[model samples]
Target: MAEWVERVDEQDEVLAVVDRAEAIRRRWLHRVATIVCRDRAGRILVHRRPDNMSRFAGQFNWMLGGATEAGESYEEAAARELSEELGVRGQPRFVLKFRCAGVVSPYWMGLHEVVVEDQVRPDPSEVAWHAWLTERELADLVRHEAFIPDAREAYDRYWATAANSKRP
Candidate 1:
């Protein structure tokens, strides 16, 4: 079955519903909702994509999420993606949203954060490897490893916002 997504405008208003593949082919803006998972110790969960898949296959990512299906809000998409990718559930708190000038396709990215206390059962087709890492370790990997481009942008923005929140 063909996957569907809402093509969105610069203001993030919906333009139309289209097939995901067509949206990619046309470089139409859409919504992709993601969640950054952290453990109780404040370590972030990172994962490597399987080598066999397309679009940034074999790259590392700190966020787990995907295209928002038609009529799905960003929060709903984030929650669904969390369950689909990690087999763990939690209420994802909204963090930020931005337009990602993607390597594959441009889209508005809605980012959320969740603390996962349950054991993560990763879907092998989506995650080849998974680990919990300190902020320092993840930052080091971001500097040295092959990471997904759009997610790297989100990571930087996520932390920037986090740092800003600490200001007086």
Candidate 2:
């Protein structure tokens, strides 16, 4: 049997627990969080989801992230996902929040980015392939439709903010 996480409604008043399969099948508007980890060399890590994934299978996305557990803060969930999926231990800084709307699953996604210097050992079950690319290269991939649309926006926003803050 698949596990189900308890989630609160958008209004933050009603609580409900739905199985993962039901959540996807019912097109529930749930909350999912992701983190973008970059290296000091200005390279960002990207991962390809397993082809068997139910949604967005074989698509390239950020290195590590997933849904936020009930009662879990966004930062806490991001940090936990980074360590759980990528095997990298570090604190992630919150960047922005975005939404991904699909025919079945509409999600409000929390975006976080972090800088790390350690090696990443991604979970084979969650990530099929991984790589690091410069911002320009990432943008090119986005242009070529090599990345998830939501991820592309997250990367662009993050890079834009970082660039603007570096100016004198």
Candidate 3:
């Protein structure tokens, strides 16, 4: 069965629904939601994508999320992805959403944050491994250019937003 995803425009206005593969193959602008889980230490949780996957295979992902289903909002999608992928559930704090061309295709990506205290049992098919890292530690790894491009953008944008908010 072909997975379907919602296609949106630059302004996030819904245009139509399309097959996920065709959307990627044609570089259609689509909606994606990412969930960034953090522990008490402020360490971000990262997951390694299985090598056999289609997009960013074998690379570590900064967020846990996927495309928005036909009628779902970004927030709903993020929460659902979190539960489905990591075996956890919570209301995530939405950080940002931006339209960008990335490793998969051009997408309007929504970045979300979830501070969790429960066990995370990642879906073995989607995540091969997982780890928690501080900002500096993640930065070191990121310098090696191993992240999915759009995720890197979201991370940078999240930090930039955080930094700006801290201004006194």
Best by lDDT: 1
Q: In candidate 3, what are the lDDT values of residues 127-149, reduced to their tens digit? A: 99999998888887765666777
What TM-score do all the candidates reach, one by one? 0.97, 0.83, 0.94
lDDT of 3 at 53: 89
lDDT per model vs. reference: 0.92, 0.75, 0.86
Writing each residue's lDDT as its tens digit, candidate 2 over 1-168 gives: 764554545643326766756776777756677888889997888789899987678888864787777667778989999999989998898876655664457666778888979988988888999899887777777755757777766667766776888821
lDDT at position 147, candidate 3: 76
Between candidates 1 and 2, name the one with more favorable TM-score.
Answer: 1
In candidate 2, clashing pairs total 0
* 144: Cα error in model 1, Å: 2.5
Q: Name the regions of candidate 1 deviating beyond 4 angstroms.
A: none
Which candidate has the highest TM-score of all? 1
| Worst-scoring 10-residue span by lDDT in model 3 | 142-151
Candidate 1 residues 49-70, lDDT tens each? 9999888889999999999999
